[model samples]
Structure formats: C-alpha cells, structure tokens
Target chain A: MNHKTASNLALAAAFAGLLSGTTARLNAQPVSGHEAGVSGAAIAAGVAMTAQDDQKLPKHSCKGKNDCKGQGGGKNAGKNSCKGKGDCATDGSKPKN
Target chain B: MTLLELQRRMEQDVRRPLTAELTMQPRTTEGESMDEIAAAYIRPNSELTSFERLEIYNRQYWFRVIGAVSEDYPALQALLGDERFDALVLAYLKQRPSTSWTLRDLSAHLPQFLEQHAEFASEQHRLAVDIARLEWAYVEAFDGAEIEPLASDELAKLGPESTLALQPHLRLLAVDYPVDEFVLAVKKPEEKAVTSGAAQLRQANVTTTLPAMAPEQRYLAVHRYDDVVYYRTLEESEFRLLKALQERKTIAEAVEIIAGEEQVATIQQTFALSSELGWFCHPTI
Candidate 1:
C-alpha cells in the first residue's frame, strides 16, 4: 500500500482497538456513580481521566461578601461563583464568600 | 421489474416527506398513492399489509435521524425546550434532509437554519445562535478527524518562514455569549438533576434563578485530545493569530497580522501553551 493508505489502515486499527477496549471496560463495570445517583465522585473521576493535562483551567469561587455577583454579572452568578479565573486562590477549591 | 427494483422503490417511498396523517396510512406518491406503490412492489405477510410494513421503516428512519440530532444538541434542546426543539429539528430535516450516509451530518445546517428563520430570531436570537454554534462545535470536536500531533521538538524547529498547521479536529469559534459553560453545565449529571422536575418547578417559582448570563464577546477553541473533547477559552489576539496561521500564513506573517508588540508576546505565550496542549500538527517547511 502507499503511505497514505497505510496511514489510513493504522488509524482505523487504532480506532477499532479503542472502541473494543471501551466496550469491554463498560461491560465489566456496573452503572455505578452518577447514573446510580451516587455522589459526583464518579463523574469527577471520568472527567479527570478524559480531560487533557495543562488544559485544566482554574475554577473560580466567590470571595468575601460578594456572593460571586461581581464575577460574571449574571442572575445565576453565585451558582457558578466557582467558575472563572484568579478569583479562587487555588484551583478546584471553593472560595470563601 | 426485478426484486432489486422493487426493494429500491419501496425504500424511496418510505423515505418520503412525513405527513401529519397516521403512520400506516397510505399517502400520494408522484401520481400514485402509497398503497398503490406498495401493492405494485411490496409483498405483505398475513399479519400486516404492505403499507403497514413500509410505515415501520418510515417511522424508524425519521426517529433515528431525530435521535442523532437530539443527541448532538442536548443543550440546544434544553434551551428551546422539548416541543420547540422537536419542531425545529423536524422543520430543519424537512428543508435539508440527511444527504450523507452518516447521521452526524443531520445538524450541519442547523446553525444556518436558526440564523435565517425569524421565529428563532426573537430577543433570545443571539443566545439561540450561540448555543447552536457551541453544540455543533462540540459535536465536531467529539469525533472529528485525528492527526498525529506535533511533538515539542517538531514545533521548536519552526522559524518565521515555517507554516504551522493546526490539528484537523480543532475548531475555533467567536461567540457573543459564554455558551461553553452552559453546554458543560447542561451535560453534567448533577446539573441535570438540579434543573429537572420538582427542583426546576421550585426554582421557577422563586425569583432566584440559575446564574444569569450577560452577553460578552468570547473566543473559544474546541478540540479533542486523548479521546475526549475540551473547550479552551482564547484571547481575541490569540484567536486572530491562530486564524491567520490556519489560513496558511507563515509565522512571521501571522505575528505581523496581530497589532502591537504586547499582542505578539501574548501570541508567543498562547503558541507555547497550545503546543503543550497538542493543538498543532507537523509544520509545513
């Protein structure tokens, strides 16, 4: 095969392998965690696994008495007070409001 | 005609435009009724008529198309609600139809459709458009074509004359609203539970609502890495620089396209960050 055809075949093989692996993993595990209405831990784990490193943007939190109102200036501002940058001192931690 | 001809005719008849009448009811086809078409081609079993058998395939086709679009645009559905979203999908399909073999192309015209239609062009028109764009970006990022990303060594060899190529799966979007967050919120299981059923009713009753979204200009890069899709917010300058690069501009030309030395610095930082994030592919020398 030509180089392009060989590359295409390799990609197809890799994709097939990924799908089979994912299917096997799903079959072996129970639908626990989020689907079972457990905690958000399962979802968090899944996100961590899939999300790229260095692209984990920091989460913002409400500071002092602001209640996150000054953050995004939305009606549901406080809801995601933990969203945005530089507001939270640490990544993934809730800010003191 | 041969059996192949008959099968083809039956498939064509079933794939016709869905009418408001009953599913199994025969409708007109060209000059002939559906029953006449079916009678001429399809062989019916003892339990059901030829038209009834054909209707089953008809409903399945429509449902599958609708389901694929819905799966791809859950956030859009949540924003427009079930009834309106269903109407929008049906209307969209009626106009465009799925010409591609894959169901993924079903919503390719949706953003443009929403743009042209005045019904969705109300006060929430911008929001609707932003949601559609974001959803489509996510869909494209999810299963878009993949390429072997450029390594740090490969990226470092690039000079002003070198042309940098972005990964095929990367999609750059300039949206008026922060629809990326909204898309993520709607997709999360916890957020779904909070916004659904009794909680939704109670929240609706109370003046306190889900976080409000004030319109703001936003630039986003939606891409897939490690088999998962991600939305990375970008600065306006960075977005412009990347756009220029993607358009086949050389590194020096891309830098010249951006205004001021500060912007050039920002572009450098963004380039470094993007490189680390595997946003680029082999550079064209």
Candidate 2:
C-alpha cells in the first residue's frame, strides 16, 4: 500500500477500536487534575496550597434587582450614601431619612 | 422639560465618566459646567449645594459600577493591576454601558473589549485577553442553562447522520495560555473569615506579581457539574471532536474530523468519558 493508503487504513483501525469500546481500561485511569496534561500530584498540591476542594460545588448567586441590596457597602456604597440625601433629582422621591 | 426628557438628561449627567480623582467631572459631555447642569434641575437643601448633591449621585454611580465590574474580573484585575484595570473598565463601560438590569451581564463584552483595547493590559496583552475570556466562561458556566443529557440508549441510536447537542453550559475555549489554573488559584476562596458585599471588592484587590507563562495553545472545557463550575483541559483531538459536535455535526462527521489526529485508545477514552459525563444530549427538533 502507498503511504496515503496506509495512513487511511490506520485511521480506520483507530475508529474501529474506538467504536468497539476496547479502550475503557485506559480511560478508566483516574483523572484528578483539572487539565489532563498536568499530573494528579501537582493538582493536589496546588489545590491544597490555595483552592477549596475542586470537586465541591462553588457558591452560586441569584442576580435579581434586590440581590444587590446589601452590597451597598465598601467603596461602592454610593446608592446607600446618597439614599436619604435627595441626590437623585429625577426620581421625584424626597429624602426620607 | 417633559418627565421623559428630564429622565434622559439626568441619566446623561449621571452616566458621564468620573474624573481621575473618582469624583464627578466638572464639565458635561456638551462642555457645560456640571454646576450649571445641576443648578438647572436640582433643588438644593440647606446643607448642600445643587452641584454637591448631583456630585454624590455621579460619584456613587461610578463607584457602584466600578465595584461590580471589579468583582467579576478579579483575575483580570490581578493581571493588569488595580489602576489600569479600573481605567480599562471605565473605558469599556463608557463605550458599552450596562443595558441589563442585573450586573451579571456587566462584563459580558469585556473579553472583546480587551481584544480591541490591548493597551490597557500593558505588556501582558495576550494573557490578559485569555484570562478575561476564561473568567467570562466561568461566569457563564456558573449560570448557564442545564438540559437533560441523552441517555445511553439514545447514544446507540445516533448514526453518522444523527446530530447531537452538547450541554448549553459547556464552554469550549482555545486560549493562548494556561489561564485556567491561574484563575482558579486567584479565585480560590479565602481561607480566613468570608466577607461579602462591597467589602469583598476592597479585599479582592490584594495584588500579586503576574507570573510569567509561556505562550502555548491550551484547550479548555469550562463546565458546571452539580452546582459548581469546573475547568477541564482537553487534548487537541478531543477539543476538535467536541467543537465539531458543538457545531451540530453528525457523530460520523465529528469522528472523521478527529480520527487522524488521535490514537485509537485515546479516541475510545474520549468517547467513554464524554458519555459518562453526559456531555451529549438530543438536539431539539
């Protein structure tokens, strides 16, 4: 067979092997790192040093209009600071505080 | 002025860029003095001048928006440092104001914004853009829609012509740097007492020296499993196959696309892992 034909045959064999599910043993090897390229030990060390458990779910927030109510602190506490100051000229609501 | 006109005018005044000192600019976009603009509409109380009253809103507006953007792009903030990141965000917000009610959509255009305005990222331009993209993917994966995955029986029914859909929340990214690890490291929950609200923004700005990362093509799948967002690295062939499947290509077509590039064993592993992970779903008719 020519080089091109040989290459095509090899590819076909690869596909056939994949379709037959013969590679489960290889895939069964545990993947602990976020990236497959990185080793599990390295990932473990990185996680241990800095991050929370990688498998644990993160805190998910619901973003609604009132969701930012208590967030009016720190440097961005603009809305809260100006709330009773009658700073909003167009809203027509007078200072209530 | 009509209420509508007054609302528009007030919005225009409030949304104007803050000065370098983080206070309201003295002049409006039309070159009108802010004092003159404020005097035209506001009724000053005994304690404050009309201009000061207006300045409060302007400063507050800028601070709130700046804080919101900072919260979403902490990794980018670390990459570019505080001063430049603030300038970049201010520039971005000016060109593309938040159209949505929620701040969740605030940084949606940030990745593209960084691509067009590379100077804001300083010398780490490419890495900054990659980090922004990765961070945005985290945002999406955190809240993106979840659909029922196709069952194993459904997989058997999928032929060369039968197309499959990947989960909507699965974000396939090709970045020029390995930003996944860096972002995870930066966003790692603080080991100490957890704080919330705008205070979190102040605490979020702890600066770290940007690590030098070599430029290499990295493929990532930013996905949410259970309720948590996770990043997975993919080999080139696996990436290609997933991308092809995402494009609604038939199983055969996707397989054909990646067959030459990957080993038989690797391909088999990819399929098995993908199926087990429920990456594939039936396309909506």
Candidate 3:
C-alpha cells in the first residue's frame, strides 16, 4: 500500500479498536432505524453524549463570601448580597449639623 | 463654563490618583496647584476648604474603586500582601481609570497590567499573573454569557467537516502555575467571621499565608454551570483540542493537529470526555 493509504488504514484500525465498545453501546440503544447509516465517528459522539448524560460532570461551587451576588443559592446571596455594606465610602451617614 | 465642561473638570479632579497617605495630590498633572483648581470649581463650606472638599471626593473615589477591585481579586491581594496589593491596584487604576459604568470592568486589564509590571509580583511573578487570570476568569464566568448547549441527539450530526463552537462563558487557560487550587485555597475562608462585617472579615483575612507550591504547568477550563463558576482541570491533549475547536477548526482538522502529538488512546479519551461535558455547539453562522 502507498504511504497515505497505509496511514489512513492504520488510523481507521486504531479508531475501530478504540470505539469498539462505544459502537456497541450506541447499538444497544433503541434504534429508530435512522442510525443504520451512522458513521463510526458519529457513533463515538453519541456514546460520549450518552455516557455524559448517565454521569453528570463534577462541579465546584463558590465558597463563603466568594459566592456571586445575584442568583440566591449561597448562604449570604440574597438580601445580604454583599452590597451597600459600607465596604466602600458613602457609609449611609449624613453630615453632622 | 458650560455644565459639560464643568462636570468634565470635576470628574478629572475626582479620578486623579492619591498620595502615599491615601490623600489627594497637591498638584494636577499639568503642574497646576490642586487647591487653585478646586477653588475655581468648588465652593468652600464652613468645615472645609474647596481643596479639602475636592480631596474628600478624590479619596472617596479611590476608596470605592480600590474596594471594587479588591472584592474581585481577593486572591491577588492574598498573594501580594495588603500594602503592595493596594499600591499595585492604585498604580493600575492611575493608568487604566474606570470608564465602564459597572465596577466589574475595573480589573479587566489587571492580568495584562501584571504581565507588563512583573516587579509588582516579584519572584512570584508568573504565579501572580496566572492567579490574576484565573481570578478574572471567575469574575467573567460569574455573569458573562450563556447559550443553549448542543443537545445529545445532535451528536449524531458531528462529522469531519463539523465546526463546533464552545459556550461563550467557557474560558480556557494554560498557565505555568496551578493557580486553580491556589485561588480556591485563598478563598476558602471563615465565613462565620464575616458575621462581624466585610471590613472586619477583610482585616481578619489579611496576611493569610497559604502553603507554598512548586511551579507546575496546568490547563484549566473556567466555565459556569447553573450560575456557579467552576475550575475544571483539563488534560493537555484535551486543552489543545478544545483550543483548536475554539478557533473554528473542523473536527477532522483538530484531530489531525493533535493526533500524532499524543498517543491515540489519550486522544480517544480526551475526545470522549470533552464530548460528554457538552462543551460543543453548532457554530453560529
């Protein structure tokens, strides 16, 4: 085989080996008959999405005062929202008479 | 003078940088005496002179802007002690004054500022820059923007010619320091102490020396999920792939760029994980 065709075949073989179970997983899904002509890359993408759907990505939430102002899930998110706290000037005071 | 001219001059006075003691400078940039300038615009009251009244506005201007910047980058403050941090912020503000109505934009230029002024960060310069970038990413992810993610079934449509776009809020950063953990460490705080007040909390959190870390390369994805910003570590291959995709490269082109750079197994895993995270969307035409 020529260099280009040989490399392409090797790449396809590698992908076939890597996506073996992935294609199986995709196949196990209820086929709506539309998946018949799906390419291996498409099958791999589908498997990845299905796996992600099954297992949610781990997330890290802001801690303590680091939580953002709006969107009230944090301990000090709402009402206290960390604004107008005299943290800045304009301490909400009137000048003495 | 016209109201617009008067207002412009007043704003110029208010936005000028303060002295070492946090007081207004004695003279303007044009070498004019500040007291003389203030007299022309402001009326002296019983308690204070025109210059002193203008100083109040000037100092308060510094206070509000510095406080806003401090709020956004407490990690940077913790990295460089309070005094140096304040000076750095002061110097930065002097050059890039707040032009946006929102305080959020105050520190937008901070990362670039640190890159140019490595002296501010000293030996920890690179780490400081990385932390600044990561912290700014957090600020952006806080409320930057969000678009509907690509649906699962749409994965079937991905092909060699497909050009996938990442979420607008997703930020990719490659740094020479593991600033992701460092920022988290700096921010993990005594919230109970804040019960006293923000100022008191600020006082208590000052001089908090975190454990030192060795320099290490890190790839990060700063993204928002459900309104909470997060830092997700990415493998080198994954980072490169996402970066290529971000540049509007086709999936086949992206794979070709990274295929031989790493083992095929690594590429396969990276592809799977990135796909699972729903980081892709149809390219907006």
Candidate 4:
C-alpha cells in the first residue's frame, strides 16, 4: 500500500481504538437516576460502524460522468492547480512567487 | 450617474452570476434588464458588446471568489467534486454575502451553513462538516491575531487560583473524523515530473476517492508557531481542562471540572507540554 493509504488505515485504527477506549471508560462509570441508561460502548460502536462505512467509499472513476469534467477527469486534476497563487497552498503559508 | 452610484452598479453587476452561463442572462435588482443596465453603465469595447464587457467582470469576480474558496477548502472540493462544490459556494455566497474586506473571511460560516443545509453535504455529510471545521480552524490559526504567549517562567508563576487565557490564535476543535491526516494526505507533494502527454493522462485517471476515515472523536488544538499553523492532538481530559481554562476558569477549578485524581498525573503532563508549546497567554491572577 502507498504511504497515503497506509496512513489513512493507521488513523482509522487509532480512531477506532480511541472510541472503544472512551466508550469502555464511560460505560464503567456509575449512572445517576436522572441520566438515561445509555451504553457508551454502544454509541462508540455505532461511530466505529460509521467509520467502517467510510472505508467502503467506492473508487470513484471519471469515466462517463459529466460533472467530472475539469475536475478529477482532466490532466491537471490533482496537480497543484494553485501554481503562483500565494494563498492557495495547503500548508497555510504564503507561497513564494 | 455619480461615481458612487456607478461603483454600486458595477459591484452589483459583478456579483450577479454564480457561473459563466448566467453571464448571458444576468439577474439584476428591481427587475432591471441586465442588458439595459450594462448599456447604461459599461462602454462597449471594439471586440465586445456592453453586456459582454460587463460579463467579463461578472465571470472574473465569481471565478476569483470560487477559486479562493476552493483553495482554502481543497479537501471539501475533492469530496464534493467540482460541480457540487461550485453549487455550495454559490449558495453560501448568496446566503452569507461577503461582509469582510478580506476574501479569507468568506468561508467563516461554511461549517454552520453546511450543518443547516444537509443537501449540499451529499452522503459524506459528517465528513464534509468535519473537513470544513478543520479548514476554517487552519485559516484562523494562519491569520488570527497573535497575542504574546506566556513564557515558561510566567506560566510557572501562575498559582492554582490563577486563570490562564489561551493565545488568541489558538483554536480548539472537537471533530469526529481524523481530518488532520486527510488534509495532510490531500496536501501531499504533487508529482511535478508528469510532463509527457501519456503520463499526464495516466495521472488524470487516478481516482480522487479519499479513503474512508474512521469516526473517532478528536480534541484538536490548532495553533500557530513562527507564523505557521500546526495541529496538535489532545487527550479528552486535557481538552476539557483547556476548554474550561479558555472559558476563564481558574486552574484549580478547570482541573476539578475535568481531571480526576487518577488523571492528575496526565493533566500535569499535559499542562507542562501546553506551557512548553506556548498554548497560553499571560494569566489573570
């Protein structure tokens, strides 16, 4: 896998772990009478399920799609379309002309 | 017509069309014919009609605004694709017209706007909102006012009763998606060597489908150091404590609010790290 894909997977795993841990901790805590008997683990699991759904985003192709024109379809798609435009750089720093 | 009146007319004309197609039949206030307004205000050049001349400004204005917004929120653009993003920008511009002198402030309400209008979010509604929030936070950290950060010694002098204020440039975000990583991935260095036609075609075919980020609640601190914006991930307790402190709670009070006896060591570590990172301004004793 490429670095980007690997990093994304790592982040997803980390987030899953975080949610699981937080949910378990919250679940272990005593619930007051006024508080609803909501399971934090269940909530976290639901969120984890959503994250898993995200991982299932089908590989988008520009073929036969009208809206993809000049977007992910063209030769300049993911390239630095912001060349010479100082404020457009992703690093939040002004690009040197 | 007076210069101010002319200026107003031009401004109105410039912001008329959300897209180039609308330039041909641009809308005007009070049901005034666009052609008539253009004819009255704009002088036709050798190569263009009065309306065409005015259309140039109209198209340019939209292009510049859209371009700036697209640059600021590239991940959002990628997620929504060009068409939906265009629609969102046009709608957002109409709802929240540019009131600030700087174009940087144009996207300030985008997150809230996305929240209210779920149609624009597509299926990735939550992802879009998180990305928008992250992008806006980055923008704020980049250009927000910079207050003098408290020195280590100054932070050390603060008693438990002292209320510490965070630096003006600091922004706290509670996000569900790991958007920071996604942003970094999107901003990864583009291959500059794809000059040949065949290679360029291959590059174009590469899918823009971003990997699905797992939904995890994250406490993020976006801050600037040496004029460059950076993201710092914070623990939940640390986030809560900092948030309380930001709300003007005294250190003791903030600690009590979020940190338990078991979390005291972790909170102390976070406090030291925050101080070292210059996350605070001068404390109000």
lDDT per model vs. reference: 0.61, 0.68, 0.66, 0.63
| Candidate 3 segments whose C-alpha is farther than 4 A from its true place | A1-97, B190-209, B260-265
Clashing pairs in 1: A60-A82, A64-A97, A75-B212, A76-B211, A76-B212
* Candidate 4: residue pairs that collide: A54-B212
Top candidate on lDDT is 2
For model 3, how does the per-residue alpha-carbon lDDT over A1-97 read when each residue is reduced to its tens digit?
5545544543443334324433443444445765445444333332111122212433222222333333221112222343333222222233244
The interface RMSD for candidate 3 is 10.5
Q: Which candidate is the best by DockQ?
A: 2
lDDT of 3 by residue, B84-140 (tens): 897789889888989886677888999999999988989989999999998888777
Binned by DockQ into CAPRI classes (incorrect, acceptable, medium, high), candidate 4 is: incorrect
Model 2 has a DockQ score of 0.14
lDDT of 1 by residue, B1-285 (tens): 988987787667757766654254466644667876776766677655666556655654555566667766777787777778878888888898888866667787899998887485467778888888888887777667777656435544656577778777778999999887677656642322235675555332212123356799999888765556666788898798788878888766666666453453465455655554555676542
Q: Which ten-residue region of model 3 chain A has the weakest summed lDDT?
A: A46-55
TM-score head-to-head 2 vs 4, winner? 2
- Model 4 agreement with the true structure over B1-285: per-residue lDDT tens digits: 999999997887877754344444554656777888889977776656677667655654555566556767878887888889888988988888777766677778988999888899867889899998888887777667766656435544656577878777788889999887776556442333345676554332223336678898988887765445667788888788778879998776776665443564556555655554456676542
Q: Score the docking of each candidate (DockQ).
A: 0.02, 0.14, 0.06, 0.02
lDDT of 2 at A53: 58
Model 1 chain B poorest 10 in a row by lDDT: B202-211
The B-chain TM-score of model 1 reads 0.86
- Candidate 1 whole-model C-alpha lDDT, 0 to 1: 0.61
